[model samples]
Target: MTLYLCLPLLAVLLQPALCLNCSSQFERTPDNSDLIVDCGTSVITLQINLCTAHWAGFNSSDLALNGNHNNSKCKGSIDTSVDPPVIHYQLPVNDSQDNPCRQSLQIVDEAPDPSGPFSAFSSIQSVIITGYIDTPRSDQGVISYSTDLYYHFSCRYPLEYLINNTEIVASSVSVATSENNGTFIDTLMMRVFNGSDYGYGLSVPPTGLELRTRIYVEVKAVNLTGNFNVLLDHCFGTPSPYNMSQSEQHNFFTGCSTDQRTTVTSNGLSKVARFDFEAFRFVQHRDQAKSSIYLHCILRLCEPTKCQELLSACNSRRKRSLTPFGEESNESATVSVGPLYTAREDTPSAAAYSNNMAPESAEDDVTGLVVGVVFGTAAAVALVLGGWFALKKYYRV
Candidate 1:
């Protein structure tokens, strides 16, 4: 009976041994024993090993039996997995409506490149002029001019308002002409209170004009009261309604040709001289008073040889005198040189040089600032989180 009671006592003591590997007691799994541990919502079964040394006269078999019977119970702890901080890559901010004037009217040959070397000359084949007209029932206006090597000119006419034969000027005239002689010319006139359905008529002399050289012509009509402006641009004939008509054709002025001659009385006898002369001299001279109309046309249609001679003469004159310093200065001087000189500076602005560039768009700058702030904040947060994790690991070690 005593041995039977001892067996029950031993069983009760063995229960504690089994509890040694309990999962709830410790975070790590027991080795070499029938034990189970919990690791963040995961169950880990472990085989725990036990070694015993019996003292003198102690029962080794009993100890072995106790060791074999040891067991454990464990319950896993709940785990909440953290989601990766969503790094919303602030998309590179950009403007939805960037109305950039990609095309520039300034002569590109003179513009400096933002990078290293100067940029190549980009030909401006055409130009589109746009404006808004409010008084005339709100209309958007656009005018385009094709590129012509011979004649290239641009002009603007301001709206003129007249009340009882009085001239009202709202905006000053805006005029730009090329200083490259024989390239462009402009003539301006305004008529007020012309008793007709049309409020005014702006007439330019040599109106139905034709040229023997490459030329560019432009005219502008402005109504001051209405605050509206109209422009007329003509390039000496690549193709158009402004092309040379049969009646418009005139004799090629060979006065400037070295091979041509006219009667000259040298020794009391009429002699034909072969001195070089401009062929279109008569036309140029006759139209001298009307250079605003004829210079471009003459240069555009002038024969190549004639054109070369004119260009050479211009270059020689340009080199000879330093009177014209800049584009506007040269234009003013050329126009003052009578009709022929004025026509040569037709594309005056083409020679303009300025140290200042056009202003930047406000929208682009604001967008860049906004994007910088957003990304900067996100990076700061990420850096703080990383530093915290590193510090925790260091302290634990």
Candidate 2:
């Protein structure tokens, strides 16, 4: 039985023009031939009947795809009891940083046109697997009719479609604004902690603070793919959910921080960025009640090269930047977290309700989100200039 994959994949099966010396006499037996590629979390379970022409009898020793030398590596079993008998090759191929089988990755980036299979995506990532089937020949003639059957196949699994697959998991609260570019989400998780090492997270965020209590904020960008990192372009705090340009606003990055104590301790170093500033309460309006402020940040995704360039250009981040962020490039996405309470109440009444920074409330704005995926890593992310090569699948002739 062929193992079918639950996740949808765009698979391309290609074959050579000649089926070795047997091409003249035999044809592929579709009914008896089975090619199953089971892409598991870590391994790709491949089950393909040995490549042989119709009614051809082949021995295990004569077969060589990955190799016939070691059964522990590339093994096979014969189903001779069946009507015509078939050689089943079941190989567990590993696709990881240590790519032993030499599988490759190719990123296809182009404008969406109304014509082809690629029309749906402006950017797509494809994993390609290639191999050849070898069968020995007897009498070598004048033309040397010896040849092996070569084959190669690829699957298109866009990062967007990666949602249901176990390959990538999102472990944070995220808000995404996109259409056909589903799952190309950008997540920026933030929290206000205390101390120099970003130590001790607040039991309740934006918890009540005294007038001179300097605040420590940490923002992390996660789940980005390819050759890119994230950068904090502009960050500021507003007294209310809305960006009130005039009054109760404090700049953390724009090369301007009212509090000179403010500093971007880390940036472009890793995934997390840290900064601190003396906490201050908004001027209580004559009709106002309690004091609250919100944090807003604009994040940009860039390749390591550009990220380094932007890191130097981000004049205000003297405070902090990626402590980590990546490459191609994309526009920016703005995300925020807060409603931090700065009002000092000895016996605070509303402090208990400040825990709304949960995932459920992450919908309204970036107010409650603490974790999520990174933007620009998906959608028409328009990036990653990998080596372009014309991979030729050849059968030894």
TM-scores of the candidates in the order shown: 0.16, 0.41
Collision count of model 2: 33
Candidate 1 structure quality by residue, lDDT tens digits, 1-397: 9999999999996663443322332332222222211111011111111111111111112221112212111111111121211101010011113312111122111222222111121211111122110011112346433211110122121111111100111111223343322122232222211112333432222332233332211222222111112211111111111122312322212112212231111110111001111213234335343233222111111223433443465346532111101122221211211122212223235343221222244566778999999999999999999999999999999
Compared to the true structure, candidate 2 yields what TM-score?
0.41
Q: CA shift at 234, candidate 2, in angstroms? A: 1.0
Best by lDDT: 2
Point out where model 2 deviates above 4 Å: 1-187, 203-207, 222-228, 242-248, 255-261, 284-289, 314-337, 344-397
**CA shift of 188, model 1, Å:** 34
lDDT (Cα, 0-100) at 166 in candidate 1 = 9
At residue 360, give the lDDT of candidate 1. 49
How good is model 1 by TM-score? 0.16
